[model samples]
Target chain A: MHELSIVFHIIKTIEQVGEENKLEHVNSVTLEVGEVSAVIDEYLGDCWKWAADRSELLKGARLVIEKLPAVTMCETCERTYATVQYGRICPYCGSERTYLLSGREINIKEIEVG
Target chain B: MQNNSIDVICAAAGSGRMEHFMKEVKILEIKKSVFEDNDREADALRGELHEKGIFLLNLMSSPGSGKTTTLLRTIEALKDRLKIAVMEADIDSDVDAHAIAGAGVKAIQLHTGGMCHLDAGMTRQGLEGLEAAEADLVVLENVGNLVCPAEFDTGAVKNAMILSVPEGHDKPLKYPLMFEVCDVVLINKIDVLPYFDFDLEKCREYVRMRNPEAEIIPICAKTGEGIDAWADWILREVAAWKADK
Candidate 1:
């Protein structure tokens, strides 16, 4: 699954940070995931639990996810709307010139250490 | 007096243990994107390729979409003019590599070990395995999937994907990211277009909607039709890439 690869990348990034900070143990990791990032939170958590425990630093570390809502900006109408509610087309002008404003992010915000 | 002082210090430590524990817990701020590392690696690899004057094309598509056949045709067409090599990536198979080697070119197979896609690091390893430094062009035949491969950059100079006639025209709409990332979309298996209800114009429109800059080339790899244009595209790209530096 793609989630497994994502988890592997996360571990690699965290390991680099751990080395730089000389961290003994990571208590938790907080992530800011977007609403339309195509990553299922449950699957990510499951994959994280299975893969994280294999690493010494991330073993038993809690995963906290913060969801960012999807918004689309209409180029023609210059109006923004919820992407989940109306996709691609602007509701005000029915124009197809629209692009995503956000909601595709997968970032590591912070880590709790002890 | 020493024994009374030791007792007082022990009582203080016992009462302050909770506060010390609380103080030990610290939050470290690290605001970073998950793809930042891979993207950096990919950019570095691109720079290295540019200095070496080698053009790398990352080819992606759904399974059974004629990716290997198109590669074979491409190699056959450009083998004499350019020093070309290939890296075939799959879950578990050396069949494609064997086929390419049989075509009289340097070829290597990369197993993803059950992973669906290859990242920049994996691509670099494959390039090293193929000893592709001497080659003018190296094509990375990425794992046959439309979704995961698009999300990961393989350090290629350009990305291309094949959408056969049988796969229908709505694929761009269904897999928007795949179409968006591709520099060119090869519409393969046009020989069977008469039998299927596939509309070429409609497909072009959909792809344009997703990516107006994407070049569409219709071809039938089996019949060797429209391959010259594809080969010419590569020729121009390789020349441009080498000349830009």
Candidate 2:
């Protein structure tokens, strides 16, 4: 699955951060996953566990995932609504002039080192 | 660093006394997007392709949605008029590449090794293999997936998606992200429109609801209907894309 590739990418990033920070070992990694993002959190965790364990800097590191809500901005109404509840049309003005504001993110929010 | 070492030593020495040792947990806020690296790479690739005046189109669709057929039709329409090449991506097998090659143009097969989607790096690799700089138009026929490919920008100048008539008109409702990111939506397989209960107007409405600016084109890839319009749209887009650069 692509989750493995993403896991590898994360590990590579974390390793670079570790090198720059002179981090001997990482305790945990926190990631913010958006509701509309294609990545599956459970699969990501599984992939991370499998890959992170092999890396010396990330050995036994716990992966934490925080879900971010999907939001959409209505251009016609100048208001925002939960994208998960409403597809694309603005619920307030019944307008199709809406764009996704956020929730497609897959951000590495924080890193805990020991 | 010295203070941490002393604290660790104290904690080990005062193992029996919990109150004697105080440890502080340190956390660094990264606040960095996981897609940051990919996005940066995609932007760089886009710049490189733009410098070469190559208009890259990322074509996505579900499996069996006539992506190859539509590509074949597109090649037939535009190959003689302009230089065209294809980077066909699939989980495995080069059947699509062979088909494109049969159409009498350069075709490079990208086997993802079971990856459902092609990332920016993968696309760059495919472009390198396809020798895209020599061609005026390079079409990246991404892996036949509606979900994963929608999330990744493949450094394409324009993103186009095909929704076949047999797939029903309600697909945008289920897969909103795919329709939302598309610059153009191609409604393919109109020749079989009479047999299926698929409504063209409803499909267009759904696409419009998700993406108001997306150009919707209905065509039958098998019969070559509405291909000239598609080719003209491409020509205009290519000119606009190059001119803007």
Candidate 3:
């Protein structure tokens, strides 16, 4: 799964930040995931466990994930709906042409350090 | 501030510590994208493509969507008329590279090593190795996936989506963004139309319902049916882009 590589990036980023700030360890890492993003949450958590276990900087650190739903803006009723459905359409207007307002995110929000 | 102030004097000192127990905690606010570096890298790559006048097309679909076949056919048809190059993304196999190498143009095979999609960072690396020296048309055949590839932008001018008849007409509805974001939609396997229940009109309507301006071209790459039309569409696009510059 691509989660492994993405997890590696997160690990590398944390280490870089740690090294720059002269921190000994990271307590927790948080991520905001977009609904359409191809990340499997459980897989990412499992992968993080394996990766964090071997490294001194991330030993036993908590992995937190927040999901962001794909926002479908209705052209007819002008309403927005949160949906994970692929080919997401506005629930109110039933418009297939709605713009996705948010979601599809993959980013580290913040890391708690000691 | 009293460190040992018990809320209820009736309870014991340790048991009356409701102030510490029910204390509200505030989270540190730091807004940042986990994919910030990736998106920034992709945006830079897009800038490069725009400057070079390279008509980059990130072709996507399932494993047997005729992705390599379509490129081969395109090379055979367009190499003489225009300069063409290919960047093929795969996990481990170089069979597609070997096949495309001798086809009479510069082709680079990028081994993703189990990566499902090609992000801008990897694509930028791949382009560094790719021969854009004697090339004008650049095509990136992504790792044949419908989900992951849709999330990342590889700095391509257009996302050429290959929808084979065997994949069913509902594919457009299922993979909506893939169909919606595509500049051109090529429906392959039209030669098998008689044996299958794939409705051409229904698919056109389906794509239009999502994106009205998207161009749909039905083709049978195996038999060369509608191949000229497909080639013509690509060439015309390249010409229009070149003229704009």
Ranking by lDDT: 1, 2, 3
What is the DockQ of the complex in model 1?
Answer: 0.46
Candidate 1 per-residue lDDT, tens place, B103-195, comes to 999999999999999999999999999998899999999999998899888899999999999999989988888999999999999999999
Candidate of highest lDDT: 1
Best by TM-score: 1
Compared with the true structure, what per-residue lDDT tens digits does model 3 show for residues A5-96?
Answer: 78877787667656654558777888988887778999999999998877789999899999877776767678888766634666666677
Off by over 4 Å in 3: A12-24, A52-59, A82-100, B1-28, B240-245
What digit string (tens of lDDT, one per residue) describes model 2 on residues B1-245?
A: 12333232111112211112225445656667776677788899999988999999999999999999999999999988789999999888998999999999999999999888888999999998887677889999998888888877889989999999999999987788899889999999999999999988988888887888899999889999988999999999988878988
State the weakest 10-residue window (summed lDDT) of model 3 chain A: A84-93
lDDT of each: 0.89, 0.85, 0.78
Model 2 steric clash pairs: none
Q: Supply DockQ values for each candidate.
A: 0.46, 0.40, 0.29
For residue B208, model 1's alpha carbon misses the true position, in angstroms, by: 1.5
